[model samples]
Target: MNETRREYIKRINIVLDFIENNLDTKLSLEYLSKKAHYSAYHFHRVFLTLVNESLNEYVNRKRIERIAAILLVKPNSSLKNLAYKYGFNSDNSFSRAFKKYYGISPTKFKSEGKELLSKIGIEPFSSEKYICSIDNIKQWTKMNAQITIKELPELKLASISNIGNFEKAGSMFQKLMEWGHQKRVLDTSNFKAITIYRDNPNITQTSKVRFSACVTISENINTDGEINQHNLKKGIYSIGHFEIKAEEISKAWKSMSIWVIENGYEFRDGDYFEMYHNDHKTHPEQKFIIDICIPLQKTENIKLGEINNLDLSKYKDNLDYHQLISYMKELRLFFQKEYDTIFKLGKIYQGAPNFSYFSLTTDELKKQKLKFVIILNHKELYFSICLSGQNKSIRKKYWKIFKGSDWNKYHLAESIDNSLSIIDQTILKNPDFNNKRNLTERIEKESLKFINDIKNILE
Candidate 1:
């Protein structure tokens, strides 16, 4: 994270702490500024920069949100009493703010209280709603840090597109599944299904929204022009993963985006991709897993060099056979070189502080046949090549023990080297790479060259 973002998070936590403790008191800009350790004059702008909402707006919204919660469990609670408890002098003011935030007045919300109670803290609650105490807030915050922002290249997809709201997403996905089954296009063995949203829910009309139920297929799949094909453009993105009911997906998106802006990254305009690995169709509601990807574009004038440099050596020990192949591909693409033959064997895993794992195969070495293993997460990549039958036998002996276990299968050998080269090219292509004008600029230049060299050698 950048310095400005760090300051923003610090201030936000201070504000949240103060609000949680003093909900009944009048929250003023000057008072909150002191709590956040910022001058009153600059606090509003800073708060808006981090939260994407005005201070008064946030305070009022949060206040109403608290009132909404109180009405749920204590259904007999009086609106007037709740209003006063939340610092509203009269019910009228509280009702207006509540309606503005939730599209319903306090009394109406109480009458139809079930829906209002279901949605709290940007996520919707299910029939099994349970109030989360403050003690669990820190755990939630820690999980928030695991979210990451990434830039993904445009994907070519064959999908069944639908124009509707979130409410109809289930039906749309069902239709796509049926179509895939009939066409024999979806491979159940490789079940990485995704939904692409072309319109932003925050701005688009419910009926006019566009969504696509998609599945990744091999490039060789022939398109007869019957299936809808889309090119998702390459761009920076903010990504997060959550295991929750489908109804609560929106909450994850809101939280992830809020964190992104708080950390000084600007959200870019593009289709958001939600890859669903498990859902009610195959898994229980509580165990449903989904990965959300939001496109992001950096707004602040920050240089890549200023960011903390990633320690590459940490991954040396954990290098997997497949990752090693990817490294080789990077070197080939960037350096324009090729090895006569390569063999790898190892088990690699992701380690703490961005460390990764790799374990080598213990087999008699041969000039012709090579063996290696690359482990990444639950997946491992193993490769072997032999010029003679005896050499192949040696490779087979080590490969037998590694084949039966469950692992994420992938074809990483073809363009492994080229991929790393592209990243290096992107950094060096920046204008600041050559100008040693300042610390940030010099850092960008050196970082770009280093990345480029790494890519060149991997090939």
Candidate 2:
């Protein structure tokens, strides 16, 4: 992924977000470059190429625009305090910069902010012309949405970027679904169809606004053509669930922005997206059921660097992915040579880099359309064996039977859509590989236990 165009875009987006949220804090190239996990030299080149502006110039412009925006809403705010807050040494310097950018003194702009901003064709975030009235807007929002402040988890998405036209989302989603099915990475059980606004609609020109038609995927995927893979970072968000017609979606957005302002919640620089729950054409009223997500400032309780403390890699084995695959092949051969006539064996399968497995089935189990799999998870450093089926339909059928009964001998997979396993048991956790023979013996013994137990149930 390194040096790719999409990788640069993803890194730059992170830096852009950090600048937006931390305008009042010291934003040095050294710190920001580290945040993007790039050298300062490469970071500068990429940022310039992608943003079409030097990093310092962009940061300065953002700071000035933020001050001007605040003055639009609060004319009497102390210029000195605001100047110092946004990284100016003195009021004189702030006033000079403001005049240079807006072509008027800050004091004059404060009095005629709306008119001045309109002349430049940049509407204030909360323009009265955009909405009827605060009360009416509130009523409309209350009728159309159920709003909540939630902390959302990180999402893995396979997305198609669509610039300017959001109407082509239907076709984009269709393409994504087809691609997802082809790759066998669709979540199926808890999948989400999301549209992420890459640029602020309020700030960017309508014809230039960017959106990504995205869907939840089960695993990491390589970027292909126009489709890219990205992780929507976990963060706090203001979520508004709405069921509205196509034409009224713009109104829903306006109302949601007003709700954030009225509730005294500051907007953060994360993505603003809509998660669609149902197809509008299916509804009698043709209303789309969706959840609009607006990123918000993390509360004081969410301490910085909290997530960094919890690293799962410590629990994983030091064995390389290739080394683990080699071991799995050895185990597969061990089973084939030992079981011989008892259970037919399959070759080792390495679907993704993180995991690999092989199947074993007896004549009786094959009649029931079932197979057993011994899997090794390189990422988690665990070995497990599972009872699976020839296909999804067989897996689902038996899954339902076990789910209804009290067969608690093993852990059952929650869904069969993306999973081949119906029932599973971890044979070894944090395996001790220093004694290779001992490890092999333990696996063989536990594997026999699972195979025999499952055979008794269905044989």
Most lDDT-accurate candidate? 2
What clash pairs does model 2 have? none
TM agreement with the true structure for every prediction: 0.36, 0.49
In angstroms, give how far residue 265 of model 2 lies from its true place.
Answer: 5.1
Over 300-385, each residue of candidate 2 has an lDDT whose tens digit, in order, gives 64333222111235444555555677888878888788889898997676534456799998888889889999998766788999
Which regions of candidate 2 deviate over 4 angstroms?
1-57, 66-93, 100-111, 125-130, 149-151, 158-179, 207-213, 220-236, 263-270, 280-286, 295-459
lDDT of candidate 1 over 1-459, digit per residue (tens): 476665566566457546645778989999999987889878888878755678887677667756765565355788888788888887778888888877778788777756553453232322223325332332342333235455566565566555465666676567657766777766566566788875444333345345677775534354332245455678766666555665556656655655554566655646678887665555412445677887766655433322111233443345433344444333223322222232232323221112233322223333423323221221222222111112334434433422333421322222222121111111212222122245234333443344334323322
By TM-score, the best candidate is 2
